[model samples]
Target: MTTIELDTTKLRADRLFQRKRLVGFAIPAVILAYLTYIFFAFDLPGLAGRANMDNAVTLVSDSWSHKVHVTRDNRSGEISYAVEGERKGRYPEGARPAWVTGDEVITIDLGGDHIVRYLPENRTEIEIPNFPLIEVRAEGRSLVTNLPDDLPGWISASNRRIGITTPEGRITLTGARTEVFNYFPGWELFWFTLDSPYHGQSLSKILFGERVDPARPNISGAMSDWWNNAMWRHKDVAWAIGETILMAFLGTMGAAIIALPLGFLAAKRFSPIMLLRAATRRLFDFVRGVDALIWTVVLARAFGPGPLTGALAILITDTGTFGKIFSEALENVDQKQIEGVSSTGAKPLQRYRFGVIPQLVPVLLAQILYFLESNTRSATIIGAITGGGIGLMLTQAIQTQKDWEEVAYYIVLIIAMVMFMDWLSGWLRGKLIGRKD
Candidate 1:
């Protein structure tokens, strides 16, 4: 009875809640419809295939033991087998072996093909080639070269001759009428073809392709060695990185000197002259407005490319930034201290030197440390444009494409350098402005 009728307001609120629930239900349906449309709306096979191919390249399959099983549900008249190994494998069939067993390990002929219809179970297969044995004929010489030999060598006897060595391990050559050979090393084949007048590819252009002709010299080994060679091992890259750091350090120091006077001139309290303060502030703004990279391009063109150009650009950019920041710090200085110094009949310069400078020291030092860290990155960027730093080598490595590992190496070096700079900045800040915690 005290409750009387249901409150109309409570009923209204319940209706709003129901409306919200209905709207929420529609959101999932809309999202589902959109996803369905996107999945079906375009040809995505190429994109999907590319992603899968990338996975395939980096994938490492579990090592398969040499023991392989070949069974005949019922032997008709023929048999076949495949030989797979560390470097290469092949399937030889039709011209079947007299017999086969799962426990046996053997080598097959390179590029030999045979058909297998020997099993009623519909098993069709052939023996793989001997591990790393490639049937190679160089010029007029016919030989089965052991891949792991210090230099490739052919079997003294028949193509079925036994024994081969490679970097991986030793393998016995097996197979009747099957020849084993390692063609000239891959790099030799490449250099051979390249040196040939008949070869159309230039050394630089071929480098771009990273293709080593099979007929050339030890191309693969040479390429592998080259890619793995450390660019930083060279004195030039070390010199470049050193110059970049020097540019940032000296540039920051020079800008600090330039900014101190300009900053005081820009501060109304410090200058006590409105016109001089306004003019200095406007000049600071004008300089800092342009990006550091733009400055690099201008100076590189104007002064020519070198470390000097890089340092100059940093100096110009930081001067403006430091000027503005220092001016603000000066404006925030406590007036009471200035008055206390003035009451002692100190001159204006003396008053500022004794009163305002002490408070401004921590803020200025903090800003300088931060700017130094920032300029380190800027120096690398400037080096890139001016063709003089580790960045130049990085760009070259990328352009060559075959030097991807070198690219990886340089990237790690740059990241390490940045981490070092960050540590230095933190230490300096703690020393100059005491740790907050």
Candidate 2:
């Protein structure tokens, strides 16, 4: 009896050990097999070859830095100095940057050994630190360069155009235009354009010192110029941010308003009819089944792109979610409270108002405020699609491929907006429902 019993127990223990061993090996094996499949399925090996690290590095650098453009219109032979090659950032009349000097042969010092000179009669000279002195001439629609047959990797030359790239700056020569880009660390003309008298004034000066613009007060003038800055577009950006917040607010509040009644119909305690409850629950599932992004796409196609359309998309998608959540909360309410309200000879409406709603307020406010915060972030992506809000501006900046700094700015703003909404939601929740602490 002892021998047989000992063998059965040992056998059971062996089987359990074997099962555990199989699981341990199988988990790692499965993971390794999946990884191997992913390596080829996603073409991870080819990703390095496809990626342009140079462009990526340049884009990263551009996000924090600004570039000044010194351009020569070859046809008119009129040289112009501007920031980022924009008309709004063009230098004032009879004025130019201190780095650029010369009346006849315009010499541009690109802050390193890199130097460029605009000579008379469509001729240009470039001086790089290590490279040989190069000269080129533009004749009508073609560029004739003194560049050797075997040029450096940094230099790109053709019959019509030539481009020289260096760490300090870049130079491009074409039949129609000759331009030099000089990189600088900070965002230039961020507060005020070249046209503004307060462009170079310090904040302290604007706030405490003498007036910069004689026609207007220092504070007012500085504010006006900064708000109206064409390069930064602070006014437009503020409006876009407002649209995004409004979209989220309208959508979230609207969804809550629509979901409340439906929630009541779905709740077992409130609506006793099985058929009505099932239908309402199904409606909730149907609306929430599709993602907000999918809803956004559908609404955009039907109603056309607008902030209101984005709000509607959010409203539709969240209605289902809110309905499910509210229904669940309603079902979990205290029966004693409802009975107490009923004992006072309260009507059905009065019972709900006094008993059910009081119990649900905490849950309702908590869910509503959370969704409101979440919807704010969602609104950004929705705004991009609906052609409204900061998302549209961010997309425009990214698509341009020229102003990475502006893209960075918009990204920072988006993050800040999300953080602010999070803080506001938490603060409101604490104030309304009492803090957990």
- How high is the CA lDDT of each candidate model? 0.60, 0.93
Can you write out model 2's per-residue Cα lDDT over 1-437, one digit (the tens) per residue?
69999999999999999999999999999999999999999999999999999879978999999998999999999999999998988999899999999999999999777899999999999998878899999999999988999988999999998999899899999999999999999888989999999988778988999977889998888888899999999999999999999999999999999999999999998899999999999989998898788888888898898789889989999999999999999999999999999999999899999989999999999999999999998999999988889999999998888899999899999999999998999999999999652
Q: Please give the distance, in angstroms, between residue 250's alpha carbon in candidate 1 and its true position after superposition.
A: 1.6
Global Cα lDDT for candidate 2 = 0.93
Model 1 stretches with alpha carbons more than 4 Å out: 1-232
TM-score of each model, in listed order: 0.53, 0.95
Task: Give the top-scoring candidate (lDDT).
Answer: 2
Candidate 2 pairs with clashing backbones: none
Task: Write model 1 residue lDDT over 20-47, tens digit each, in one string.
Answer: 9989998998999988788778646556
Going through the candidates in order, what is the number of backbone clashes in each?
31, 0
